[model samples]
Target chain A: MGKTMSEKIFERKVNHAVQPGDLVIAPIDCAMGQDGTTPLAIKSFLDMNAQSVFDHHKIFFVIDHNAPSPMESVSRLHDEMRSFAQKFGISLFDVGQGVCHELMVAKGLVVPGDLVVGADSHTCTYGALGAFATGIGSTELAVAMISGKLWFKVPETIRINLHGTLQEGVFAKDVILFIASQLKADGANYKAIEFHGPVIDRLEMDERFTISNMAVEMGAKAGLMVPDDKTFSWVKKRSKRDFESVFPDPNARYCEVVDLDCSFLTPQVALPHRVDTVKSVEELDEIPIQEAFIGTCTNGRIRDLEVATRILSGRKVHPHVRLIVAPASREIFLHALQMGWVEEIVQAGGVFVTPGCGPCVGTHQGIPGDGWNVISTANRNFKGRMGNASAFIYLASPATVAASAIEGKITDPRKYLR
Target chain B: MSWRGYAHKFGDDINTDYIISGKHKFKTLDMNELAKHVMEDIDPNFYQKIKPGDFIVAGKNFGCGSSREQAPRALLAAGIRGVLALSFARIFFRNAINCGLLVLECNTSPIQNGDEMEIDLLVGKIYDHTQGVQIEARPLPQVMIDILQEGGLVNYFKKYGSFRGV
Candidate 1:
């Protein structure tokens, strides 16, 4: 049988042909732990009585989730992380560096065909570059740090072929939300999801990252797209790292095949408390929103900011709603600033937060109040996710969020777009 | 590999956010302190109610959302014996196992709250002493069982030096 993309990645890691269900301790190309999970990993690594990290250069520690050290306690964690990084000579990204997933790709730390692991679930975002990446626990990260290898049960691949073209108003966020609606939260549990077909070819690098970033919402181990000319060219601008393009064979065995037609898709939103509870933007009741956020590893790229800016340039945000804009990384932040997107966003009454996780993780900066309603472009809408259990969070595309911020309600982006 | 405890039953989609609220995140690294606030948002009395050596039985998608290892570590610190659910998110499953916490998959609806339950890891059987019934659960693979036997991956690594099987 022909090998799936996941199988191909694993085969290279193990240095042998492997099939689904095979458990192998494969060498990892990169290992990461963000601020929220790194402290624990450091403790575990010490608890294991390890003398030093297996590969100092290959491991990364990012301080993005609670950057600026929201509190003294969080600052202490950062202090410990700094100490750990210094002692082992590992790369450490301090506050304002941006989210780890974004920084990893922006810095060209992750290349195609690499097996990457992180302590944060959204680490799967790296797969947008065709890398086989997944999230594990802090303890597992500790083990990988010590040995540079960990065990993985090679998962069966599920083919999700996206056909047709996305309408102007429908963003990559909408496409992922629609897919999650069909797959439910646990639909792809323990499986590798591979996106193919013509629609994928048209998606930009940032758009591809947005889709792969949410694949974990449906329980996918990894979400990947084949690296084509666009990928090569975009990555070329960032780094000259030599990476072999990996793709699935034509006859690859698939556990299931799901075909998504992008032509009929509309702007989508996920309601309160569950990502899978998705609906078309027009079908929702007229809900008033108190806050609108536009940033995260999912939709915090320059392209996403441009979309929000393009819609908000000539309009002012409703006086009742607070719009917060966060860039994914320092590089993206500067890029957006230079391109005048930040000026347009601010003129529209959008509050620009630091280039870190910020409200996306509920750490600080623009947390919602009791019983308040929020429209955000970030992934996940679980209860109390924004630091208030009584508050409601709605997930939508950046365009939709920008439009709703202007109307003070859940307004569809298509209505405001030119 | 066997465990016996009272059932602490919960409903479906009991996400990691509810297991240990984000409010507590980065507040402290002490798992014991974290255990004191486990499930504080969902059930305010959860920490006070749960005793050491208790088992959590829940519906589908237990420990879903956010790949925080604290979710599993908090339970372990609180002395939870194991978790039995219809299913689990992939990351949580790995986290729980890495923490030396037992996670089994089975239809947990029939397991009532406060029921005395015993699980035989070797036999893949769950015996409800309170209900006088037995449910067959999918057994863990040998690799997982061995890891649990070694008291999680850290200990396993300590004992064996490096992981086997490339």
Candidate 2:
């Protein structure tokens, strides 16, 4: 029996071959906690009464979820985080840096074959670079911070091969939404999803991140794409960290294999309240929307912004709709500003929030009102997720959100795309 | 470890948001306070109705969504002895163990709402006394059960100390 990419990653981390269902103690290459979870982790660390962290450089505390301090209490949490970081000499990315996962990848902290763990579930996002990353609780993270090693039950791998080219208007967001629809919410429970084939090769690194970011919605342990030249180029431009490329064995055993042809895919939308409740843009009714949001860790990168910029270039947002644009990271925000994408989006009546996890976690910024139907490019549309249980949220691509912002309703992006 | 409780049933995909609403996340960090609102959205009286040593039984993918440990923490605070589900999200399972909450993956829903159940973690047995059914759940690894026996990972670390880091 051969090994999958994640299996190989665990093997490298543990210095031995691992199979699915095997429980092993693997050395952690990187561990992180965000503002939403870090305070608890810090508390756990203190409760453990440990003198110091295992490795200062390998651990990180990011203040992104409630970036810029949503309130005085939250600011106090920030102060606590800073004090903890300073006390332990751990890396701390303050407010406005970016979401933790994005910062980790952009800063070159996540290399191929690295064993990464964070307190946030989307920590699986780093698996896009071929690293075996998964989310754990704050206590587990605190344990990692104290000991630098954690136990893992190596997960079975489910291979998904994409063959056909993504049709126009059908962005990477659509591909992931389509996959989620097929898998339902719990389809991949406790399994790692590995993407393969030419279509995955064609997706940009940012696009791959978008796919892996949503893997949690399908209950996957990790969503992995083997490192290729594209991944190498992205990492090379970001950091000078030395790394060895990782790939699965030719006969790597998979629990199951799913074939997805992107050619037939259209811009997909996850209906209100459930990610798996998906419908194509054409098949859905044109329901009016009170708000449209185009940003988040899932679809707030430079390329996504450019897509929004292209759709909103010559037009203004509808007077009735409130459109919010949030760049995933400050680097992406600066790049958008330099490229004039920010200016174009602002001129088209899109309000820019801070370059953090804006409105995605729903703890801060641009929350929708009661009974309002809003379209967003964020990953989850779970009830009460956007700070309001009465409000409805629809998930789609940045282009679809931008077009809907202009139309003040749920409109397909293909009509707006040239 | 062993537990005897009545089942409080829930359906599939009971996400963390429903477990402990984000609306109350910033209000306080008190686990007991958050327990007052556990599953408030799904069952407005869930917190009020839950008794000490109650067991939460659910369909597949229980505790799915954002890795807010509060979900499991709230259950522990609310005196939920264990959660028996067809499956669970990965983070929730780990969090449950760390928080000293028991989670068993049952191959079937052997117990329904209000049914009396007893679980023996050491023996990997679930006895649905009300339904007169017996189910075998995957036994937890000895390491994890040891940690749980120590009242979660923090206590385990306190007693055993931690691994030296590089």
Candidate 3:
């Protein structure tokens, strides 16, 4: 049996040996709740008649989706969440802390080889740090708050080994998008994807996060990267808090493995209805779109901003295109403004929205009407996800999305990588 | 948010966006408009077929994504009696219980889809008429039972808070 990093982490958490099919209950080290669900969870916790939260420090309640978007409806939701937080004295990040995924990693809430759970499906996003993270319901989160334990089946591990460095204009998002497109939306359900290869080794923490963040999009349990200097340096900067680090032993077992040679890889996109319905940019042309959005927890990092700015350096978005760029958080937004990436986008006539899940959740702040086709950096281009079921969504890398936003058609980022 | 119903069964990792969806995270211009979409995503015509007061028996990790209370709220609106699963997502479980939706956990469900279950939530047990199974849930605290019996936290607060809600 070739134990992958995930299996090892699971073993440590449960304090027992585990196989792919074995069921195990492990204590969730960190529990993250976003505002969309926090108020309700807090209400439930309060309703439970518990004197106080199970543990104060273990819960991270963040208001990410509607932060700074003071629509009448948005404000109501925030007000409710705020009331709950104030009542409970829970760890809350309300003031433009950024998307919970990136924010948690940057703030040192996640530790390698830890079992983390969240109220959001994207809670699996923390897997980038090699933590076993998965999404749970608010009910489970409530239980986790009170009980601090989570139940999960020991999932089969899929070993993905990549060879060759990414070509110019291609980044981690593209790589992950391609992987999801190949695996299909439900490809790796209840499975752990152990990412290996020199390509991953060279990836920066943010890039690894971009990939691991979307592992759940493939219906995966988690994605893990072996701890290296990048992981070590990233951790060192965050905390001196000491916890044991985990690594897979040499003779660990794996249920399956696949290899990809990235030397020939290029820009790819997943058309609607399914994330795995992939097509290369080279094959798509003149697919005119009404809207282009370049931001989401998946692709709204500072690096994503740099890629978009690079693509729009000397060109303006097409006249027919309505483009919106929402940074992921206040830090990213302010940093981009300080770095002038936001200006480059604005100068190109793109509307730069605030850092919440503005357009991604279809809150209608950036919604498109009937007959619209949108290209976004967010995941889940499902039908009717973005306010219009008739409308089409095309998912692409930040560079590809930026390039397409400029041209109002599907285009490769490498074509404008200069 | 208080509920009295029979339990129905389901599988694990029941995601919220999958249950109700992020689009319906808040009160909508049209409430019933989302019912069909919710059913379509989970089970088409689920709203119509699911009997009132039937407990939902599910596997583990139920309600696995987004803290969207709308999922359970939708379930309550759709006339689910209660949720019975091996486990629940943190928020969904709490929200359902808060919103007067009865959510119970049994080690395993002997009741199947059409089981005539009579659940005495106050007693924390479900009498499965069809399967002759009587499953006991991990009982909630007495105060919680009062909160549920009062039709949710709001009603409880309204009665207890001296009209602070007003």
Candidate 4:
């Protein structure tokens, strides 16, 4: 049988062929943990009575969540992370550096054909570069850090073919949301999804990152895209290391194949508390929002900011709504600043915060008040995701969030786009 | 091995945030302290109601959001013996196994809140004492059983010096 991309990647690691449902131990090329989970991982590393990490350069610790220390307790955790990283000489991305997954890709730590693991669920974001990345628990991270290897139960691949061009005002976020609504929350549990066809080919690397990042939201082990020139160009600009890309054979067997036509797709929004509860922008009643946020590992790239800035260029944020813009990384923030996207957004009444996770993880930065409704471009809208259980969060594209901020309600972005 | 517990039933897509709210994730990493507020968002009296050896029974996609280990750690600290669900999020399943928390994939429809239940790991059976029905669950792999026997991955590592059995 022809091998899928996942099987091919594992075969290279194990020096033997692997099939779905096969359990094998493979060496990890890169591993990462953020402040929220790294402290626990550090504790587990110590509890294991391990002396030192297998490789200092391969492991990374980032302090993006609760950056700048929301309180003394969080500050203590950050300090613990710093001390641990320093003692082991592991790479540490301190506060204001950006989200871990973004840094890993932007800094050249992850490349095609690498088996990357992170303590955060969105670590699957690196799959945009053809790397097989997945999230694990802190203890697993500790184990990987100490031993430099982890076991995996090879997941069957699900091929999704996207054929049509996206409609105006729709984006990669909308495409993924539409897929999520069809698949539901656990539709792809423990399975690898390979995105193919024209729509995926036309998408930029940043947009591909957004799609792969939300793969875990549907319970996928990894969301992989075949690396092409766009991927090579992006990785080449950022990474000095050579990498070999993996591709699925045309005759490879898939557990399931799904075809989606993006031509008729509209602006999609995931309602409060459930990512799968999606609706097109026009289908919803006028729901007022108190906050509109445009940032996170999911949609905080330069392209996302450009969309937000274009929509808000000659408009002002509604007096009642607060618009917060946070870049995924300091590099993106600097780039946005140089391009005047930051100043234009600010002039339009949007607030700029440090380039970190922002209020996406509910750690700090812009936690919504009680009963407030927030329209955000970040992934995951589970209850209490924004630091207030009573506050409602609606997940949408950056364009939708920008238009919503201007209207102080859930407004269709097409009108603003036109 | 056998376990007896009362089921605390939940619905589909019970995310990790509902298990242990994000508001409390950074408040403290102390599992015991976090356990006090476990499932409080879903049921305010959950912490007070659940006794040691109780089990959380839910429909599809339990523990679905965020890869935070605290979600499982909080449950383990709150004396939850195991979780019986129709399915689980991938990361949460691994996290539970690493934390030595028992998670079984079975038909949780027959299990209700306050129902007395018994699970036999060896036979992969769930006996609902309240309903007087037996549900067969998918048996866990021997490697997972070995890890659970050691009380989690950390213990497994300490005992074997590597991920040998796994």
**Best-fitting candidate, scored by DockQ:** 4
Error of 4 at A118 (Å): 0.3
* Candidate lDDT (C-alpha), each: 0.90, 0.88, 0.73, 0.92
> Model 1: per-residue lDDT, tens digit, A1-418?
8999999999998899899989898999999999999999998898889998889989999999888877999999999999999999999999899999998888888888999999999999988899999999898899999989988999998899999988889989999999999999988999999989888898899999999999999999999989998888878888777888798999999999999899999999999989999999989999999999999999999889988989999789999999999899998989998999889889889999889887977779888999999999999888878888889999999999999999999999997776
Off by over 4 Å in 4: none
Maximum-lDDT candidate: 4
List ranges where model 1 is wrong by over 4 Å: none
Model 1 clash pairs are none
The i-RMS of candidate 1 is 1.3
Backbone clashes in each candidate structure, one number apiece? Answer: 0, 0, 42, 0
Chain B alone: TM-score in each candidate?
Answer: 0.95, 0.94, 0.83, 0.96
Once superposed on the true structure, which residue ranges of model 2 sit more than 4 Å away at CA? Answer: B107-110, B162-166
lDDT by residue (tens digit), candidate 3, A1-418 = 6577888888888788888766566777878888666655655566565455557778888877766654677677677767766766767787467778877887888878778888776777777777888776555566577667755668888888989988888788778888887775556766888888988998888788888878777667788878888887888798666767788777878777788887778888888655678788888767988799888778888888888998887789999899898887788899999998888899998898767676776665577778788998887776666755567889888898888888888888897875
Q: Per-residue lDDT of B95-162 in model 4, one digit per residue for the tens?
A: 99889999999999988789999989878899999999899987887778888888998999899876
Clashing pairs in 2: none
Regions more than 4 Å wrong, model 3: A69-74, B1-19, B28-37, B40-69, B80-166
Error of 1 at A383 (Å): 0.5
Please give the distance, in angstroms, between residue A7's alpha carbon in candidate 2 and its true position after superposition: 1.4
lDDT for each residue of candidate 2 in A1-418, tens digit (9 for 90 to 100): 8889988888888888778988888889989998888888888888989888889999998888877776787788788889999988998999888878889998999988788999999999998999888999888989999889988889998999988998888898999999999999998889999988888899999999999999999999899998988999989988777888679989999999999888999999899899999999989887899989888779989889999999999799999899998788899999999999989998999999888888887787888899999999999998888888788999999999999999988888887786
**Model 4: lDDT of residue A360:** 89
Query: Model 4 chain B, poorest ten-residue lDDT window?
Result: B157-166
What's each prediction's TM-score?
Answer: 0.98, 0.97, 0.79, 0.99
